[model samples]
Target: MNLLDIEHLRVDLRSRERRGAPRTVIHDVSLTIAPGEAVGVVGESGSGKSMTVKAVMRLLPRRATVGGTLEFRGTSIPAMPGRDLARFRSQLVSMIYQDPRAHINPLRTIGDFLIEGVVASGQMNRAEALEAACTLLRDVGVNDPQRRLSQYPHQLSGGLLQRMMIVMALLPSPELVLADEPTTALDVTVQSEVMAILTEQIRERSVGLLFITHDLDLAAAVTDSLAVMHAGTVVERGPSADIYAAPRHPYTAALLASRPSPTSVARPVSIPGRPVSAFEAGEGCAFASRCPYAIGQCRTERPEPRTAGTRTVACHRSDELEAVLAEGVRA
Candidate 1:
């Protein structure tokens, strides 16, 4: 069974300006991950990547209403009782936020922050939790685990704090990890190191990972599969190498072409038009306005996800435009 299974998942928030009318933020998003597999969710900002993770964690705002199937190991997450939900959050899955500073308490020591969750959840006593944390900290390449634990969040560098957060996430031996751009706050050098540590640890522990990031290159580098999201929906999804080499969806192609490549002398192609939120999208395809291959039909009909070669794509012209997208990338 898959470690995580999400199908046709929808999330809506009550809009105050609209007099409590619900605005959809996530629409028909489906993804799955297996043990020791890393699935990358890549998209532009406000594309519902973070919101999807929040839904899995059941950390959505009180006003948010979720729909569709959200299952972990064949069990319904939304239907889990209070005690089961608590255990689910503590033992089954853990999240590593992008910004560690904001998540960590300024007043708490590193040891206190790391040990509190495990102890509170009854996973381990305080002493055992602290020892496990110190060992994990050392394993992640942080020197002097004992001294680091004595310090506060402000005393550590961004990279160190992120590594410590990785330790916290793994301390419980969770079946899955939701990493929301965990390396976004560090420098390029630090980012690479932190990512390497994270992937290594997860792989060693045979834990599933759902990595959310906007950087396509970084996502492709570390993840086994790639899911390209736009307007709160997955536009394309497949193996990382196949999707990177030949994107089946126009949005995915445009995203790849827009990235800066060291080997390419040609200028990066800039995608036209601004991205729309799920609520702002019309009945037709959300990307129709900006898609160069869009036709009259694309403007009036929403395309459902269909298998195209090795990937699933939601595009009216995917069959005819596949070559065009690949050629455009080569140019």
Candidate 2:
């Protein structure tokens, strides 16, 4: 079953002005996830990656005007009202947001955090909630669960705080977990552990995961599918290996090249030119200015996303570029 289906997911953060103008944030973006599937949304900061999910979760502030079909478990999420919204967020779908320190309350104990944070939202009682919280901590690989329960957020390390948030999200046993950079600010070792715990927990519980992050490498490590967002648009998406091995879009290719490689003797190649914002698009392709393969057609008319051979590309000259890359590799 399709757990979540988001199409033409446009989110404009600006309100209809008291005068007459309006601004925008995210443009048309689409994606789907099957039950228990883990899909990663990757992009630079302010790319509308977070905003898009925020729209779906209905977590965006009142000023935003959103237009799109967000279906969760065959039901339209955007159309949900009153209790349905609350019910869906708590019992069906959950979000683990970025920044654990800021998220956690210094005044609250871990048990209090779990209740006010996760357990209190649903049907679990205080005793059951406490047990559930302990189990969740253990499940997320935090040792000495009982002792940790008495500790505040300030007492925990960065990695432990992150693990706590993940546990709380999973305690609800939600069908879909939208984790917004769940492993951020942790060391590489702790990052790996968090990923392992999350993947395992999601799989074991048969929960679909929407893992959002700026780290393409970490996303590749944890997800089966990759969706690359640039300046509020998904410029490229494909199977993780396929996209990593051969990114069809210039933005995707540039992102891959920007990462350091052990085999490389020099610093990583940087992708020149900044990405276009939601309200700031030129006449042609969004990536044309930065695309090395762009031609005159690219500068005049925007290209819709299309499948070329094996991968999808939104460039006017993608076929030629693909051929050139293929031939160069062969040589």
Candidate 3:
């Protein structure tokens, strides 16, 4: 069975403006992750990538109304009772936030944060959890594990803190890990190292991973498959190498063209306009205004997802766009 399965997931949050109606942030988004698979969700900021995963983790704000089926290991998430849900959150699934400092309590020692979940879940006693924490800390490359655990979050570097977060996520041996841009705040060198550790750990343990990031290159480098989201919906999805080499959607192609390449001397082309939120797009394709290949039909009609071999794309002009991308690759 797939480790995680989401279908037609829609989330609407109460607008911050008191007078406005609820605004939809996630629109009918759906994806699945198999056991031991690593799937990357990529998009520009505010494109609902984070919201999608937040929904999966059931961490959205109280004001947000969520609708859809979210299942993990053949069990429904939204319908899980309070105690079952608590166990689900603490043991079956884990989340690695983008900012470790924000998630970790500054006043608490690292040992407190690391062992809390295991102890709370009643999987291990305090002393046993501490011993396991030390082992995990060592596994993630921390030296003097006992000493480091005694130190507070403020004392550790960003990379080390992130590694610690990974250790916490793995402590319970979760079937799935939801990593929401866990390395974004770190420097490039640190980012690569952290990602390497995460990928290696997940692979060795046979855990599924849902990695959300705005950085397409990083997503491509680490994940087996990629889902490109836009305006609260997935615009394209496929194997990472296939999507990177030949993007089917105009937005996906634009994103690829915007990335700086070491070998390409030509100036990188930026997307013509800013992204539009889901509420801003009524009936038309959300990217119609910004899409270079958009036609009259694209301006008025929202396209449905269509599968072609190993990929899926929601674009009326995917056929033409595929040809264009193919030609560019040939050149």
C-alpha RMSD for every candidate: 1.1, 2.2, 1.3
Point out where model 2 deviates above 4 Å: 15-17, 117-119, 307-311, 325-331
lDDT per residue for candidate 2 within 1-331, as digits (tens), equals 6999988788776555676556668776788888888899999887888897888798888888888788997889878987888888888887887788998888989878876645546578788888988888877778999999999989988888888888878877788999998887778788888778888898898899998999998888788888888767777777777777767677777787788776757678787877678667667777778877888988889777776554555666666676554442223
Cα-based lDDT for every prediction: 0.93, 0.80, 0.90
How well is each residue in 1-331 modelled by candidate 3, as lDDT tens digits? 9989888888999978888899999886878899999999999999998899888888899889998889988788888889989898999899999999889999999999999999988999999999998988887888899899899999999999999999999998998999999999998899999999999999999999999999998899889999999999999989999998888998988888888788878888899888888778878899999988889999899999888999999999898777896555434
Best-fitting candidate, scored by lDDT: 1
| Per-model TM against the reference | 0.98, 0.92, 0.97
Q: With candidate 1 superimposed using the best TM-score fit, by how many Å does residue 289's alpha carbon deviate from the native?
A: 0.8
Best by TM-score: 1
Give the C-alpha miss distance for residue 268 in model 3, angstroms.
0.9
lDDT of 1 by residue, 49-162 (tens): 999999999999988999999999999999999999999999999999999999999999999988888899999999899899999998999899999999999999999999
Q: Higher-TM-score candidate among 1 and 2?
A: 1
Q: Which pairs, if any, clash in model 3?
A: none
Pairs clashing within candidate 2: none
Q: Which residue pairs show collisions in model 1?
A: none
Angstrom error of the Cα, residue 188, model 1: value is: 2.2
**Best to worst by lDDT, what's the order?**
1, 3, 2
